[model samples]
Target chain A: MKKHIAVVSGDGIGPDIVREALKVLFAVGAKFGHTFTTSSYLAGGAALDAVGIPLPEETLDGCRNSDSVLLGAVGGPKWDTLASNLRPEKALLGLRGGLGLFCNLRPAILYKQLSDACPLKAEIIGEGLDLMVVRELTGGIYFGERGRTDDAAFDTMAYTVGEIERIVRKAFEIAQKRSKRLCSVDKANILNTSQLWREVVKRVQGDYPDVEVSHLYVDNAAMQLVRNPRQFDVIVTENMFGDILSDEASQITGSIGMLPSASLREDSYGMYEPIHGSAPDIAGKDLANPIATILSVAMMLRYSFGLQAEADCIESAVSKVLDNGYRTADIHTPGMKKIGTNDMGSLIAQSL
Target chain B: MKKHIAVVSGDGIGPDIVREALKVLFAVGAKFGHTFTTSSYLAGGAALDAVGIPLPEETLDGCRNSDSVLLGAVGGPKWDTLASNLRPEKALLGLRGGLGLFCNLRPAILYKQLSDACPLKAEIIGEGLDLMVVRELTGGIYFGERGRTDDAAFDTMAYTVGEIERIVRKAFEIAQKRSKRLCSVDKANILNTSQLWREVVKRVQGDYPDVEVSHLYVDNAAMQLVRNPRQFDVIVTENMFGDILSDEASQITGSIGMLPSASLREDSYGMYEPIHGSAPDIAGKDLANPIATILSVAMMLRYSFGLQAEADCIESAVSKVLDNGYRTADIHTPGMKKIGTNDMGSLIAQSL
Candidate 1:
């Protein structure tokens, strides 16, 4: 097997953590009899420094030509004063729009070893937490028509049947592969877009009858996430609601440093990254956590390269590393063996 | 002072709980040197059974004519199969629209005695949770124009300067009387309406110089609620965001049956009720908790009638009753004296 990957070590502590991720990826390739090639491209603040643009055309083209993209965190306080469109964060928008990545998969999994970090009580977080937030990335009010006047302002929340169908189909497929349960979140009682969302989800469910499906209003869904998170498997929602819920779900795990996300197009092409932000204050320090980025490579293997066994092997190595009492600075408990980012990544690679 | 109250004990446990609340109200009136009058109206499934409509013309008129309104819970499975417009819950919409109650106040207060009921870890719920959610009810996406075509659907989220100003002023006034810290949540970076909201809130801040103000995106706000709820004193947001956040806040408290809410208009007219739903299964049994409805009366005394001392008396009495080991079925613990709904209400009334 062979794969070519585009890598973006954007800014701040990004380069430090991303370096460790590639080491783990190389270890996976060596263990599994596969060829893995990578191309480094500048983006975000790194690109702004070199070319005065957050996202260069060459970088976008490199990502487009690759099978998948692996990204470190982007943006820092240094670029915070830049104009909105020219800021380092805009590079994310440019890449998503240019690559046509519309479906966002945020996995909020709380490993039992780190359950002590979760904000929820032990009773409510029974048997550990594993839920996927399937967020519609390209549609809804974020991309809707908006305008402001002297006295008023408005934003449109619009959805086409095609938009709803694609995401719903993706969610159902993922649910079928996992626990075979999907909960579609919407505000159908108030919004027209929500009604259309429900209709399309129902239409898509017919094609995947084995998956149990349910519906909840966005308000109720938010409450349920805090009350009994164990009930959910895959939760699909619109752009803004998803934006709110996925963050809430991530926070409750109390280990945002351990979570990774994948944004995909209709095809297998996708971009994987850690959900945590770049810590500029710790840039170039060996203290930043690298487990999230390493796990992101695992997601890339499963979702983009159709390498489930390799992905599972990477995940197992991560769990085994934790079991043997290895810890990065962010997730370190007093009893655990604390190690630097480089050592943490090297240990996982050795286990692989 | 004399006041006339319109009482709507709508469905299921509605009648049972409202009776206990009224008993508490009369006790307050007897001790506070005030005169009170009351009129009962049918407005929910009960109204549907009698007058063939969930909200009859007379009930709306009666509530409009009164100085203020006190309502019990509404809706049940019996009314669940009805058409959307004819459902028992529509009566709530009718009352709010008819009375012009545009500001919804949801208070998530977890009593220290009931801290065990909270879903968050004991360390996270330090000092107990008491935060107010001031939600804009009549504007934003819920009241905006919506339409659906065969292939697409859309809903407009619109806000006017006047609308935002009124809600901001009300929130500011409420904050002035409470902790004086206000957290305004919006998605200004994306939506035009949110941009206007921030602008209007900034303009309104000139009149509220004594109140410390801060802003957060809705997603971050949701995460903060679970991570550190005690940090918030008062939170104001758009209708949809409010709807989602208030519910989430209520659930984290884990004593939903003990929370109360209020809906107010510009003038001093308002409607007060419990945040919990009508538990049809526990309707006629003495198991329902009346603390929320009784607390609603306390809110009415303070907000609608400007009787702060009287409101404080009611609140203190309710707390004192719990201190004396009286517990309703919903909030009962092993060593506490468990009592029926009527007995719990009587104990609070006697304490007042």
Candidate 2:
């Protein structure tokens, strides 16, 4: 099989970690008797510095031509002084909007080795935490009409029935693939947006008879995520609420550095990236964790390239490395051998 | 001092908890040399049943004439099938809106003896968790324009300059009186409402010279609350965001049954209530926890009646009872004796 993957080595430690993901990808390709061609492109603060645009047209073209797009984390304080419109974070957000990617799948899985590190009790954390959060990427409060006046300011939490139905349908499809359980989270008890959300979700649920559907107020859902994360299978929510809930869900795994996300449209190709931001404070240093970016590569393989075996290989290799007591600063557990950026990445690749 | 309190024992566990809170209130009044008179009114499902209106005109008149109002939980499944406008929860929400109760303060405090009940590690949970969540009760998505069409729906997240200023000022004022630290949580990185929120908070900081101000995105704030809840002193956010975040914050202390909230307007007396909802399933069994309602009574004394000693007495009594390991179903910590609702209430009053 031949696959072309576009890589965006975004900023700070993005390049270093991305290198390891590529190595792991190459190893998987070889093991599975498959060939993968990688193309690298500039984005985020680095692109702004090099080519004067956070997301250059060349980068978009490269991604559109590829089987999948893998991104390292973006933005740093160095670009903080940039105009809000030209800031590095916008590049990532803009790409999602520009690509018409409406479904963001963020899987929050707690590994057995990292269970003790979670704030929740061992009993509450359960054996395996596997929940996919299907966040509506292009709609809701994030892209709503927003502005500030001298006396007032406002942002809309708008949702189209078409948008809600599509995202809900996507979530139901994913649930069909997984545990066949879906929980739609909204603030229906208070907000009008949520009331409409509930109505649309109910209508959408009728289409998926196999999927078990439940509704939770956002506040209760947030509490339940920490109290018993194992209870959830697939959580679908609006953009801003999903943005907040998904991050909190990542924390349940006891490692933000291990979480990866993918934003996709109806097409097979998608943008994959680690959940963490560019830590400018630790940029030049070797302290940034690379597992998140590496895991993202695994997602790119499974979700985009349809190389499940190769994706499993990358995932298993990372798990084995962690099982061997390797640690990065962000996810350091007791007695784990603390390793730097290149060393950890090398260990993962070596395991692969 | 002499005071009259409008007591609205709502529905479900409303009457049970209100009875306990009144016992403690009477004890506090006697201990502090204050004269207290309570007029019990019907609201919520019960009021709707009796007067055919959730918030009766007489009840509103009672609240306006009284020095303070203490509400037990509202709503039940019996009334859930009623019209949306006639439902029980609408009454509580109606009172807040009608009374112009803008500042909603929910304090998440972990008792010393109950610290063992926290799911997080003792080192992370630390000695005590006390943080007041100041939510703008009157504005944002709650009261914003909302509508649903055949294919789309919208809910505005609007904030006026005056609303933001007042809420931020209230938070800083509360912070100055406590740990001298305030955290303003918003989605500033994404929403225009939050962007204006940040600017308003900065401008308001000048007025509170002694307090330190910190800003965090709502997502990061949610993670930090779980990661290290002890780091925060006070958190001020918009209405809907606060609704979710405060609930999450309350869960960190192990049970929603232990948290209380106070909603106040500038010129009027405040309304105090427990953060927990009516547990319709356990309404008649006398199994619901009443500590939150009792604590809410304490808040009514302090914030509305200016009865500091009376408030302190009620708080101390509740803590002493918890120290004695009298458990309710909600806070069923290990090895703790689970007692019935009335017994726990009696124990708290006995401690007083």
Candidate 3:
């Protein structure tokens, strides 16, 4: 097997963590008889410093040519003074839009090793929490037409049937691969957009009869996540709801540093990244955790390259390290052995 | 002092719980030497069953004439088959709109007596959770202009400067009375409506210097609610965000039966109710919890009548009862004495 990934180690702790994740990727490639090649691309503050732009033309082109894009993170206080459009964070918006990635897959997995950190009680969480929030990223309120008048300001949440259909189909396909349970969350009782969203979901659901489908109003869905997270497997919703819910799902797991996300298109091409932000304060320090970025590589393998066994191997290796009482500074407890960024990456790679 | 209340004991357990709450209200009046008068009005399924209408003209007129309104609960399976506009739940929307109830106050209070019921770990909750969500009920997405085309469906989220000012003022006034901490939740970075909302929140803060003010993106706010709920006091947001957050806050408290809400307009006049729904299955039986309704009475006294002593007395009495291990079936534990709705209300009234 041969794979080429566009690597954008954006800024701050991005370079450091992405380095460790790539080491693990190389380890997976060697063990599984696969050739994984990566091309470095400038984005975020790094590109802002190098070429005076947040996202260079070369960067987007490189990602478009590659099988998948692996990103670390994008923003910091250093670029806070820059104009909104010229800021480091704009790289993310540009990439997602330019690449035509319509849906975002964010899996919230509560590791048993880090279960003590979870906000939820033991009984509520039961065994462990593992759920994916399939967010329709390209459209919804965030991308809607908005304007402000003298007395009033307005934002329009408009959704075409085509937009809803694609995301619903993607969610159903993803559910078919996982636990086969799909919960479509919307405020159909109120919003016209959600009504259309619900209609499209129901229309697309007929094709995937094997998948168990259900509907929850956004309010009830938020309550259910806090009350009983174990009841969910795959939660699909529009952009804004997904943004709120996915973040909530991550918080309940109690470890934001360990989560990875993939922004996918209709095809297999996707952009993989750690959901956490770039910590400029700990930029050059070895204090940053690399597990999220490493797990992102696993997502790229599983979702983008269709390398299930290889992905499983990488995931298990990371889990095994945690099970063996290894810890990064952020996720470290008193009893666990704390290791630096490089050491943790080496340990995971050697284990793989 | 004399107060007139419009009592709309709508349907199902509505009558049973309202009866108990009225008993406690009478007790409060008896102890304080105040004249309290309640006019029983028909609404919801009860109104529909009697006159084939969810909310009658007489009911609306009675409520408008009263100092305050106390509602039990509304809607059941009996009215589920009714036309959308004629359904029992339409009474709520009608009441909120008809009364010009622009702002909704939902208090999410975690009782130490039922701390075990809370879904969060003990460490996260700290002392206990007590926060109010001041939601702009009459504006934003719920009341926004919405329409559907053949290919696309659209809903407009529009906010006037006056609308944001009113809600922000209400929330600040609420915070002034409480711990004096206000958190305005919005996605100002993206939506134009939210940008105006944030500006109004900022402008309103100038009038209240004693209160500590802050802002949070809705996604981060959702995460923070699950992560550390103790950090907030009064969270004010637009209607849609409020609907989602207040429900999440209530679920985290783990006893939905104990929560109460208040909807208010420009004047001191308000409509109060339990946040829970009509438990039709327990209509004839003495199985409903009366505390939420009783609490709603306390809110009416505090907000509408400005009878702080009466409110405090009612709250303390309820707490004393719960502290003494009295519980309704909904909140009953193994060792706690589970009493019927009538007995629980009688006990709280006796304590006062």
How well does each candidate reproduce the native contacts, as fnat?
A: 0.98, 0.74, 0.98
Candidate 1 vs 2: which has more DockQ: 1
Q: How many residue pairs clash in each candidate?
A: 0, 1, 0
lDDT of 2 by residue, B1-352 (tens): 8889899999999888888888888877787788889898889999988999899989888888888899998998888888778888888888898888899999998887777667666777777788899999989988888887777778888998899998888888889889999999998878888888899998888888899989998999989988888889999999988988998888888767888899988854899999998887898788989999999988888787767777888889888887777899887778888998899888988888
In candidate 2, list every pair of residues with a backbone clash: A161-B151
Candidate maximizing lDDT: 3
The candidate maximizing DockQ is 1
Task: List each candidate's DockQ score.
Answer: 0.91, 0.76, 0.89
User: How would you encode candidate 3's per-residue C-alpha lDDT over B97-144 as one tens digit per residue?
Assistant: 999999999999999988999999999998899999999999998898
The C-alpha stretches of model 1 lying farther than 4 A from their native spots are none
The better-scoring model by lDDT among 1 and 3 is: 3
State candidate 3's DockQ: 0.89
Q: Write the per-residue lDDT of candidate 1 for residues B12-131, one digit (tens) a residue.
A: 899989999999999999998899899999988999999889999999999988999999988998888887789898899889888989899999999888888899999999889999
Instruction: Kindly report which residue stretches of model 2 are placed more than 4 angstroms away from their true locations once superposed.
Output: A284-287, B333-335
Chain B alone, candidate 1, TM-score of 0.98
Worst 10 residues of 2 chain A by lDDT: A117-126
- Of the pair 2 and 3, which is ahead by TM-score? 3
